[model samples]
Target: MSGIEDLLREDLRGKTPYGAPQLDVPVQLNTNENAFAIPEDVAAVVAEFVGRELRGLNRYPDRDAVALREDLAAYLGHGLTADHVWAANGSNEILQQLLQAFGGPGRTVLGFMPSYSMHPLLARGTATAFVDAGREDDYTLGPDFVRAAITEHDPDLVFLVSPNNPTGTALDREVVEAAYGAARGLVVIDEAYAEFARDPGSTALGLLEGRRRLVVTRTLSKAFAFAGARVGYLAADPELVEKLLLVRLPYHLSSITQAAARGALACAARLQSEVDELKHQRDRIVKNMRAKGLPVADSDANFVLVGGLRDAAAVWRAILDEGVLIRDVGLPGRLRITAGSEEETAALLDAFDTVLERRPALFDLQEQAK
Candidate 1:
């Protein structure tokens, strides 16, 4: 008899699930989660909201999630309304939904490589062809390059991640405009880290006026310290928002989740207060790492990507040995670290120092001869 694995989808049979190491370490700067705890007042409010739904657990939540979407729109404030927004479990699901609606079988979605790694995985799960258009050596997306790539691929969907993951490079408005103009299909901008961006006014939300094909996804995980709550949403043309309903499951957002998210949105200001501090720590990491002669990428996200490692894997292991955990994102000679609270940042810096003290040559760009 054949093994059960033989019955699995051929494409997913040997693929690895998307995840990072979740070791229980003294310091975890790997996942780019906001390190601060929710404020007591905010926590109390969220608890109250969630508690209110206990009596109504027997009834299904509003299939449309109207009130939560309204709260999200108010928080985003780009003249958006509930009709233009949709919520889901997380931004990953939001991306998956987009692929399900617009990208399945035979359709192609083009994304610049070294972006959110999940973009391609989501495409694969939806049975869509994923095309990687390489970015510049520095990982920056130029308008000319974007336009040319879209023209060549003629993809059905294009994913542009602003303040992109792993590298923390933010896309210029010209780049987004070029992509929108050159692509014949939908354009999805994953802005999960937009709250951590240096220029608050530079969001693609400003570009949504007449572009029905554009979608901007946001998450409360990074800036709002609500990672555990798993609330993510997207803003797009009302028509596009309606189309997602066709693919979305019934009562997708539970009453508890909806209430908790609404409660969090009520305290959006308080939760976002930690954003400035996180940005400060991110810049500090860039400045400090560069001062130590490592090539650190300029970051508009909560994490910084550091290069010039002689052996990224070895260095990662050494750091973890010191009770700190950062991410080795499969980039040769490069590693990524999240900006945590002050104490966690100190611990991370100290761990790096301890690792480097014993192996001063770790910063050497060239690999050792075999």
Candidate 2:
């Protein structure tokens, strides 16, 4: 019934892809997006920036993304200049670039399990082996585990996310430092959620002080509220930056994208207030959820992960019917709900309460287990 193109990859054939809801739903807590809208004033600036570049649309964008990179370096560096800064459509692309450059053809890409999911996906799509040495049930990464993996897997590239996705746990500096100790391969720290990390200064980007082989990837999508802008940057040593550039698509970042990204970067202070507001709300929801005996993960990112439910699908289905769309991690009862605005957060809580109540069998088991 199916054509040959459908079975082309052979390995990828019959694979069920992961996806979020496409149906129109209110209070979308599904995607880990900043629920707060970009402030009108900032939006105005971005609009102006785009307007300025309107005529240039006929021509190609800056292939090197020099202006945007300069702005990102300035914002992230707090004035220090680092030529290692690079950009792409989204930090996701930046990640793919790293994978393409370091991992391919008889090499392996290694990452801890239950991460952003793209690590292994990228490896698979590019004809590489994916090795997951992720944390077990408790969800903590031990330096010993990482060290053992390096010795065993000898991966060409290792991918890690701090404030790791789905589960918000962050690998502390010590663990990361240990990874950097090895001189063999590149370690990419996907800091896409770094905007909401516990302490901003403690970011891997700043930690790079002068280290080589540690590439820290960041995005404007989260804290900057620029998800539609598709802007993300990587901070690394100049040499590694050069290697990544070799494989980057020409004129990869559009001029409009560059202008908007640069404009947003210039307003970090303004964005921090929004981040603070979201964190406050997240803490409140988390505390209340845990107080009610729900097992929530220690998330270092913008969302909260509520695990240990009896049936994740039941909870997800119930909540969607209630007009709120929270993301299901497909891990059976693990939901990654974004920290929405105050009203949205309240609606989410109400939805959860309703869902848990309706799924009595599930919650009953939860209580009995507790």
Candidate 3:
């Protein structure tokens, strides 16, 4: 081993960095990024605000990002205010900060498997113990199962990703509450895809009022077409938000970033229209995949998870050879497909049909409803 490797922290020595291939392909549907680009009017607003913030670059940006937090509070609209919100570069940083404050050596962070893969990485980065639990065979997590895991693991931090990544299934509100009641420490609900859920009320934000230990994180990356802006925030009791301040680095949110997020919030109407269209595409993908007898998960996010393949990697390569890129998330016999533009979706379906025609044995014809 290299001398530098020997000098590295023990917990980090053998760990590889998180990555998703960013290949240049004709129809890219691997990452769950918003299909639409920022509208011209919204782009103008972001440019204007950023231009104004450039003059004050000499001074330090707002250490607390108060103005941006206020705009985010208004955007969330669940009786939230600046004091109840905290902003960061992205949800990853926010999660890391939470671990810094609530998790450390000897403390445990627990999450169900097949959720956001980053949960364990964030825990390990903070020198925290990570516990992997299981979901139902169908990938739906029930309250009883969650409560049992919490009771057994007794983790210092519990992560629940609604509209979970890779699987794209959302948690019921009752399940969230049960987890909160069972957990002795902090509970964070990663709702990064909440904006695209089938029902507007399918959120843990409403459950935040009386629950101080509960946290709900939201991002502008998906539905808002602001992934490039890297804005993610959390809503919780002001007391919990205060604890994060102790661990967050000073001036974490750059002046340009703050202004850009606020500008995106100002153009919420246009952004919602884009989100609606993406939802349409998501539903269309789900419908078409099911008709072909694939077992597709019912999704509230901008993606669908399909199973019953004989070899997922082989299918993934076939799709790539057809100039379409989708994600093979290492789930046995399954692949995740991001909802793209109408033209892109059509291209992907055509690619799937053509490939399946050649290798009809690749997938099972019996459809499993989820």
Mind giving the per-residue lDDT tens digits that candidate 3 earns over 43-85? 9988998999898999999999999999999988989999999
Instruction: Decide which is better by TM-score, 2 or 3.
Output: 3
Residue-level lDDT for 179 in candidate 3: 95
Candidate with maximal TM-score: 3
TM values, all candidates: 0.97, 0.93, 0.98
Reference-based TM-score, model 2 = 0.93
lDDT of 2 at 359: 70
Off by over 4 Å in 1: 365-370
Q: Name the better of 1 and 3 by lDDT.
A: 3
Return the candidate ranking by lDDT, descending.
Answer: 3, 1, 2
- Encode model 1's per-residue lDDT on 278-309: one tens digit a residue: 99989888887876778887888999999889
lDDT of each: 0.91, 0.81, 0.92
Clash pairs, model 3 backbone? none
lDDT against true structure, model 2? 0.81
Model 2, 40-83: lDDT tens per residue?
88888778888999987889988888888788888876444548
lDDT of predicted model 1: 0.91
